[model samples]
Target: MKTFIASSPHVARVNRVDSIMLQVLLALVPGILAMIWFFGWGLLINILLAATFAVAAECTVILARGRSPLPAIADLSAVVTAVLFAISVPPILPWWMTLLGMLFAIVLVKQLYGGMGYNPFNPAMAAYVFLLVSYPVAMTNWLTPTMLAEHHLSFTESLRIILDGSLPQGLSWDAVTSATPLDEMRGKLDRDLTMDEIRQSPLWGAFGGRGWEWIAGWFLLGGLYLLWKRIITWHIPASLLSSLLVCATLFWAIEPQTHPFPAFHLFSGAAILGAFFIATDPVTACTTTRGQIIFGASIGALVYVIRTWGGYPDAIAFSVLLLNIAAPMIDHYTQPRVFGHGGKRG
Candidate 1:
């Protein structure tokens, strides 16, 4: 047996890619369950389809690149990306659209930029924006929550809707679908309705959208679990929520009749989910401590701005993608001082 001297520093691998990705998947479970509970089986079906296709895409792309597919696909990154993308899209989105988004996310966004760590943008969000922009109607065709819904599609029915294009014979689209809470609020406000008047709808919960806010709370639970496990830090989620709250509070204080309360901003849309899960993506978000705060704060502010006045309803995907593009510059400027160095980089 030939025993050779080892390298200078023996680095042990504690958080392997597969392990960390698995933790993320586990953390998403509660939220996924809550989504299915509220939104019906379409959400689950889409997630399954996306995850399967995403894995296949990863294998095909890796083989084409002359790399071993197992090493990449086994890491679960593609699955995570698919899950995130699936959750973001309309539950009953056509099957081909999901496949297209997966291909764009895995082959183009992730692999085209040299895969995983090398990709500057978050593949899930980039694919989401691509789908949202290219097929606006399909992307926005969300189902009313189960509690508010007159009809809830079964698993098989949801599968048929996705694979095919419509509801059953007499089931018109209006029987089940409606505008999202944010969209509803914007439309009403544009008509010059006061927040008090808007709150008259049963769709309004204690603060946020009726069922949607609880889904966000379930996501918050998962995020807190991740924080407890040390899978993610507090800087991003804390700063993101705080900044959004400040903005919402300031605006609401200025015009109580027009602006919604602060809790609305925190619980609405993807605020809680994006704060903990999406914005904390290690590859695309800022790395330094101070940079992370700035990155999260910027995203939160943009969410408020875009949701309030922009064309789109929810702004997580747009805001996250925008900040991801600027993450490198943020890290560069906010780097901490070296141990033995002087003041700061400046």
Candidate 2:
């Protein structure tokens, strides 16, 4: 009998790009359902539209580059990017804008940067910033939650509004759309309203915005599932939330009247989602454990600074993009020593 010698240490490789991407899609379900529940059918429409556009764009780019589209498309990275961008945008965003964002995300940001692992910035976030910069009005026109809206448009009406920018005779944009919770808080703070005064509005919930925090909670639950699956480590999410909480607590502690509570920072907007899903992208984020901690913390701190004083209402996209650029350097500096490496590299 011949004995075959394998490598010294062999481990089963159970994770693949497709499997990982599928898990991410599954994790997003709870959050997506929550969003649809609160915001209505527009959310569902945006997601489908964006996903379709993303796959189309990915195919086009791959064919243009002389590659078979099937393999690239099978990975589902494009769909993940589409879902993230769609969920991040205003539910009432026009169909054209959704298509435009998907094109930019897949073609310009992802493929043009040499595809997938080579791209320095998170494609979803890059596309979001692109749309926000180019079409501020559409990007900011978030619909009022179902409970708060004076009138809820039917599916057909929502479709018409997104497709052709048409509204019923009796309704105006202001009647259906309202500022997001983050936007509302920023506006109120700009007007010198105290935190107590701002919380008096029906928009305010126990921690974050009415109906919004629940969505964040669902995302949090999904993130925890990801962590438990070992698909993602806790370093990024843990450090990110900790840094944001520390910053928010410090500021709010110093001036309770001016700063919102730490829980508000954690539960509002995309803080939890970004920490778990966006910032934890394997290709664009730091790989080393220590580097990931630093990378996540920097994003968290930047989010706090920008939300407090930057021009934008939420800073997750901006902060993530900024950190994505630095991830390579972070990995370089924080690389783990090779197994039997000397104490010094002399």
Candidate 3:
């Protein structure tokens, strides 16, 4: 009779790669629904297009390299990458632009660098920055939550809008497109407007700004769900948010007229999502708890510094990517020592 043997930690667990991916997909539902409700079927179109292209790109690369594509596609990481890419993009982006981003993300950022675990940067953020630089106009066409076309988009119509720049008469993306709250606030600050004056604008809300608080809320809910599912931990998320708050509190205390409040920073573009989903990517983030805290805090600090002083209104992507590059070094210095290890010699 044959017998099976196993290593230590003999307790069994139910977690699998597929299950984790499924949980992540489920967690994104709230945010995806929010996007569709606000931005219309254009969000759906982008998601479908991105998912399709990402799988295709991955398969093509695998085939060309004489490797098995089925396993990779089955793991669902490609789907997650596509979803992240789609969500980060403008809803009304032309289909070719979306395709280009997927190609870059899947082929270059992901596969060419030795596929998922080997890539240095987050594929989604890399594509986002690429699109932003390559097509500023299309990438910046963010639809305002309250502004939708009179006629609701059918699936085909939504596809048409994404594939072609044309929309039905009087159904301009222009009507829906508006500046994000962070961008608006940054613009006002650039114009020498006081923080109080800027906060009094129509864009301002109770905690965050107009049309932004709801989306942020949705992402936050999803993030909490992920945490509950044990797909992620609270260390990184808490550290990231706390660091941002600390920075914001310090700045606001020094000069309230110049710096926006902590609430505004917390509820603005990509803050919640970046803190949870993006920065907590296991492959890219620090593994140990201590390293995670340091990783999250560093990203939060970078986000504050970049958002306030750097050119971009939202620095989540840049901050996360920068910290990802530092994760290895963080882990190296912060890993716990073995029980019998002696103290370091002078």
Candidate 4:
């Protein structure tokens, strides 16, 4: 008898990317509901528009590459990306603009970089920055919270406004929408208003603002669920929020009128969302625990610096993308000691 031996390749498996992405989508439910309660159906239309375009664009790009489109689109990554992009955008963006943003995210940002795991940047954030730079007026037209704003539009009217870029009588949605809390604060500071003066406005609420704080709270809940599920580590979130608090407190102590409160900075704009979701993106973020903390802290510090002195009122996208560039170096330097090995290098 002759014995023949051959080495077999090792294959390791876990849940598919689709399942993880689906889990993220599920976690967004509370935040989505809160947005609808405050912002109305405009966000719904934006989600649908961005999601549809994302899936279509991904499929189309995959097919162009002679790959299976179904598998790529089925992974639900496109869905998550679309939702993130949609939520980051102003509720009143014209349908065509929304579509263009989705296409840029799905094609240029994701596919052009060889798709999901290989992309160096968070696709939705990149798309958001693109839209913001190109369409500043449209991007900043955040709607007034339902509780505070006088008029609210129906779902049908929202759909019409999003698709056509105008309400009845040729007025643009921008005319009715309210300024974001960050915008309001920056503007008031420029006009030499103190923090007390800014807070006295109906625009600011306890902790954060009328709609902004609730949205941030809802997203924080979602992030906690993700933590409970073990989908993400706590290091990133802790570092990001802690950095923000320290920076905010230091500045507020120096001059109260020049800086907003720490709580307000923590809850306003995309601070919580970026810390919990966007900055934690495994592909674009650091892999090791220490590295993740450093990456997150870098993002938090940049966000504060930019918001205080840079051109934009909210700096989450810029911060995240900037840190994404340094993630590789962060991972290299912060590599943990190998288990059970002597406390020294090989």
For each of the candidates, the C-alpha root-mean-square deviation to the true structure, in angstroms, is 2.3, 2.4, 2.7, 3.3
Error of 4 at 37 (Å): 0.8
Worst 10 residues of 3 by lDDT: 146-155
Q: How does model 2 fare in lDDT?
A: 0.93
- lDDT (Cα, tens digit) per residue for candidate 3, span 1-346: 9999988879766777667888888998998898788677888888998999999999999999999999899889899989988998888789898899999989999898899788888888889988887887788787666542345665676677777766766777555567888888889899999988887767678788765677789999999999988999999999999999999999999999999888999987888988877888878899999999999999999999999999888888888888989999999999898876877766
The clash count of every prediction, one per candidate, is: 0, 0, 0, 0
User: Candidate 1 or 2, higher TM-score?
Assistant: 1
- TM for candidate 2 is 0.95
List candidate 4 segments past 4 Å from native. 1-14, 169-175, 338-346
By TM-score, who's the top model here?
1
User: Which candidate would rank higher by TM-score, 1 or 3?
Assistant: 1
Candidate 1 stretches with Cα past 4 Å from truth are: 1-11, 343-346
List lDDT for all candidates, in order.
0.92, 0.93, 0.86, 0.89
* Segments of candidate 2 deviating more than 4 angstroms: 1-12, 339-346
Residue pairs in collision within model 4: none
Instruction: Say which prediction, candidate 1 or candidate 4, comes out ahead on lDDT.
Output: 1
- Point out the higher-scoring one by lDDT: 3 or 4: 4
**Model 1 per-residue lDDT at 259:** 95
Q: What is the TM-score of each candidate against the true structure?
A: 0.96, 0.95, 0.92, 0.93
